[model samples]
Target: MARVAFILLCHKDPDAILNQVTRLTAAGDYVAIHFDASAAPADYRKITSALADNPNAIFVTRRVRCGWGEWSLVEATLRTLQAAFDAFAQATHFYMLSGDCMPIKSAHYAHRFLDAHDKDFIESFDFFDTDWIKTGLREERLIYRHYFNERSQKRRFYAAFALQKRLNITRAVPTGIQVMIGSQWWCLRRSSVAAVLAFTRQRPDVIRFFRTTWIPDETFFQTLVRHLVPGREIESRTLTFLMFSDYGMPVSFYNDHADLLLGQDALFARKISAEAHRLKQVLGALYASDRTDFTISNEGRTLFSFLTARGRSGRRFAPRFWEAEASIGAGRSLLIILCKKWHVAKRLTAAIRQSTDIPAFDYLFHEDDTPLPDMGGIERSLAKRGRHHRAFVRMLYDHAGTDRVVICLDTSSLDLLGDFHADRADVRILEIDCDLGDDYLIGHAIRVGLAGPQTSRDTFARLLPTIRRDMIHERDAIRDARFKNAARLRETATDAENAAALAVFLGVDDTTALALAQTPHLFVD
Candidate 1:
């Protein structure tokens, strides 16, 4: 097996760091980590404890504060490489990664493939003439030296014009040299790392020169490799993983995007949020299982293992009617009338109205709808009383045409379902929020051993929303309703008050309640 060394730069979120380390160490690869001294000792100790038993792991020298766009990143990276080189001399290559970074490939494939090239894969793009290095740099340097860096304020004020001149000249200078940037996370041979350290040691002036420039991380290795061997040994292309970018933010992958990631044949991908359990399950089966040939972690786990996975499926996709045409079944042309309280409902209604096939929707409660007395004489002027109270009341009468599918807003529940009476068959109140909340709670209940799989899926669905809503909306009216146990309702009501029932008392969807029940672990404190 080709040995690999993983280097992680740790700062905050020690739990996340520990999980990454555990997964990497379990993969049978050597690991070296540099925790920025900027973090508290307790946090540092926590990560250290997690890696204590691993023979392939080492905690590097003391951490240092890394200023963004400065030499700190390169300094930290070099320190990690030096430590990895000394401790695991037999390792084939060193992979630089961040604490939140995840591996998209199987370890077996990564090890075999990396063993072949085992050369420098840094990607440098030329930008000497670009405004990023010219005008932008001059403007930023003045701001940084004079205002941001208090220690060098007086000295910078005198040299400010000179610095501006230098940046202008730099913009005109074309050093056909490209500043390599693939993934900051790279798979590099030991010789490449040794060369980086050796060159840095001999040329302290070069190191100091870059330390003064912005984005030292991008330039540090780029300058070294170019100055060291020119175009002889260093490969222009990088072997690291890739992720697509749109606009500015990264395009996150879903289970639907699985084929794209796998087909790309990259070593790793940028990031994977723990919230998507369905994607995790799909990816786990594909990449983290024995049936498949590729494996990234030796411990037989995938990137999903580190994140909280409970109730993930519920949030994956928006709820939608599967068969409006089929279900309508020759009835008085079914219309899904969107009610108020759900702002997104207006868009949905407009979309349905625009559709050629489906029954058109009647947008109610809009300015065109008949105004209520409290809604003021103005066209769409509903009185602005307490925000939550007015919202629920407006929701009660938002629908215009009675003969339609009066699906209530996200705030819709069985309790409020009785207010509207259209054609009994046509008036279906779709309790979307209630349904999702039930599913999330059920998932959590199962995970924490609060309920068995056989436990009624409808347990919370039928009982809680009504009971919870009543406690919130009509706390004083509890004396009227007939209940098997009034005291139990009161107690649950108190729990709701302290917990998420407050949202119910206010008029918004019970997001607080659903969030608490769905992510119980998060609400532990």
Candidate 2:
């Protein structure tokens, strides 16, 4: 097996840091530490003294006074990578991690997995295409310059932000480089690390451009890897599991996440706070055992159940589509009933099953008031506003790995047509009309149930045309909206304010404003 080098960055939780260092050292892996300069000298010394006897462990002498969303983080990581490469010349891979991160898989299993795969494990996504930060809008981070002091002074940061906005001194990325954003953590081959380091050394201009950019640490390496490396050799997935809150902050793992963490194939999990003493203990015990077969405890199962229920009720995104899909079966057709009326949904489900012999299929009713079974179904909490229908659509396509999905929604749920435009081939929508004299079904599957039971294969054949027409109309509407919004913004602003206002209107940064303004649909919809 190839030796793995771990580059850890830490500022707080000295004890947890030492434990991580000790664990990696015990696994016969090289460990490089980059303690924040603002951290206490006593804490640094404590970490250093604990690893004094381990020749494989080395703390970089050059430290950084790191601040959130600052270039200092990138500099510190580059320095640590260089130091690790210098110390362990034969190491095959470099894993960028944080002090709060701990390996979930055994060292042997991780090494074996890495040895078998030639590709680098780094999550990189086109910034314009995906919501990397889950901000609902994708381009805000790329457009604005976010400045924070070393101690995270909110007032100072906001004041600077407002000043920049007023003065109209917008920051721009380097020319000819497409912005790519992803999780900061990654596992890269040694050659890839070297390539990144060489690119930075050769392009000092790129470094300077990103220095003023917000959250450069997340974008810098990702942009380089996408620009420099072959796309085929990069697997766009991180090996670490980081649970994020609705506000985009990384949440600390607790005993409740034990089953979730244990079930994941990711090698590491991160952002473990010092307060989670019991979680740390459980993880430590699990990692210390040599046995590969482990079972979730009764308490873990109970906690998982509670968390699963809470996750569905919460307004945030919940990824239960896979469990729902699996409970039904693979290859089984899925009918997602998005109607608010329970009787309407029941009639639709019954009509579909009675009318068609579409092989094995299951029904998942999504309603606000009617509570469906936890398994093979989803029920929205009545107290909360439900705007996460798009998230549910995304989960079906992106997470659940379902190829064929039929959505049966009422006229009120027609707003969800926007989500099916991109994946119309894989998804079909049946717009059911509850009124007696109106067209009963008005989507891809058009059926006029006002006269008689219009349930047949020919009725289903008209679905694709209706769907195509709806998709085209929706797309055109979105295109027109973007154009009108951009035009309105351009007309209302003065010459000095046009660039900033245009960027805001287009939902992109000034660096991308010219290109984005020309193609407003790329960023807006």
Candidate 3:
């Protein structure tokens, strides 16, 4: 007879399971172990042979094949729980655990805690009413029939789901039960286990309903235990500490994570790395110690570290897919002049070139498909600006004698703007909120003879405000390299205003900026 009986479900790493069993039974707690049938037969033989003489350890008679996101895992758990429930008649509680789990507190403390509380420690909630399902299907998981394995046959699984959805086929929930969802770990009172087993015997239909349920192991015991135990007797929580990554995958604990695992508020920590031998040995020694369960503590330093780490991090600069010559971007600084009008960009390029020794290019990404500046000697097709956009741009830094180059861009190159302006380290954005109502485009088109001077300006000026607001929003919404680039942008309703803002952006004198702005016509062809 023991205070708590543990039902341990394990697939791989029989050595780890054996260690857990030996530790639990040594503290006078019963452990019923189940090895997944899909695993090597020799792993089962290994554990059974190791614990051949221990009376507190009993191997479950039934073995089942289990798969991820399938119903067989729940079957494995049910068999393991039944073996434990039948073996330890006088045990006060049954704790469900995985082989990856390690006790956070000494067995004596856990035993005493169960006796004091007398509550079932299980997480459960009404599935139809909660925001708990974060990544996958919530109602669709239950209502539809899944004939394909989601893990192994992703294409078939999706096809089946699509077919069911298209056909509008849905199954009803088993009668008289409110479906519940929770973490797949729990510790239940003896009476709770008895109630679950009784339900299994009386309601084979419900069991059948779950056999086709997706990830039933997460829902089965949680739903039943909620129905079986009274409200006051059920604690809506788990005794195990587990965490997931931002991508929803389980976060594995390593030897370096020993301190963090020890500091968790749970009585057990799970999904420990199988390769974490040092961590396992250190935690395994706790079974002999007299430590009780601890409160999460007032360690301001540790909490501070966690809060700081968990807080929103600075957004990363995504270099475009030109992977081969990415290193060239670091060779020199880049200033990209962005404007919605071709005339404005042309004017800015001419102004920057005349006022500063820095080389400037006129609309490098323009659709005209001209050769890149200083690359006129290369073959026309190879040197076309759009052929390898990012690579060709990055390579220009190597040819520039100075440390920086100014490249002007207009609406024709809007797609490149998204990728070009994103590099926070080496690239600075000079966005000209140039005059939207300027007739310079019409004037330039007439002078160039593209149209017969009868072409009217489109309604782009009416939409410029929203575009500007959206640009500011985009900058504010994304995290910077850590912060925004200094003095990188400006707005202007006239040439004088453009000069003032450009003076601040570039460290040029106000007089020089004014000259550059006023004398732009000197270089415009």
Q: TM-score, each model?
A: 0.47, 0.59, 0.59
Candidate 3: clashing pairs of residues = none
Residues 433-490 of candidate 2 have per-residue lDDT tens digits of 2222113233212221211123333333333344444444433443442321122222
lDDT of 1 by residue, 41-150 (tens): 89989878877888878988766676555567778888888899999978878877876455666666677777666456665555443332322344343123222222
Count of backbone clashes, every candidate in sequence: 14, 3, 0
Instruction: Give model 1's TM-score versus the native structure.
Output: 0.47
- Model 3 lDDT per residue over 302-358, tens place: 322333343343333344456434443554667777665556667667767777877
Model 1 Cα shift for residue 62 (angstroms): 1.5
* lDDT value, residue 403 of candidate 2: 45
Model 1, C-alpha of 514: deviation from truth (Å):
69
Worst 10 residues of 3 by lDDT: 451-460
- CA lDDT for candidate 2: 0.61
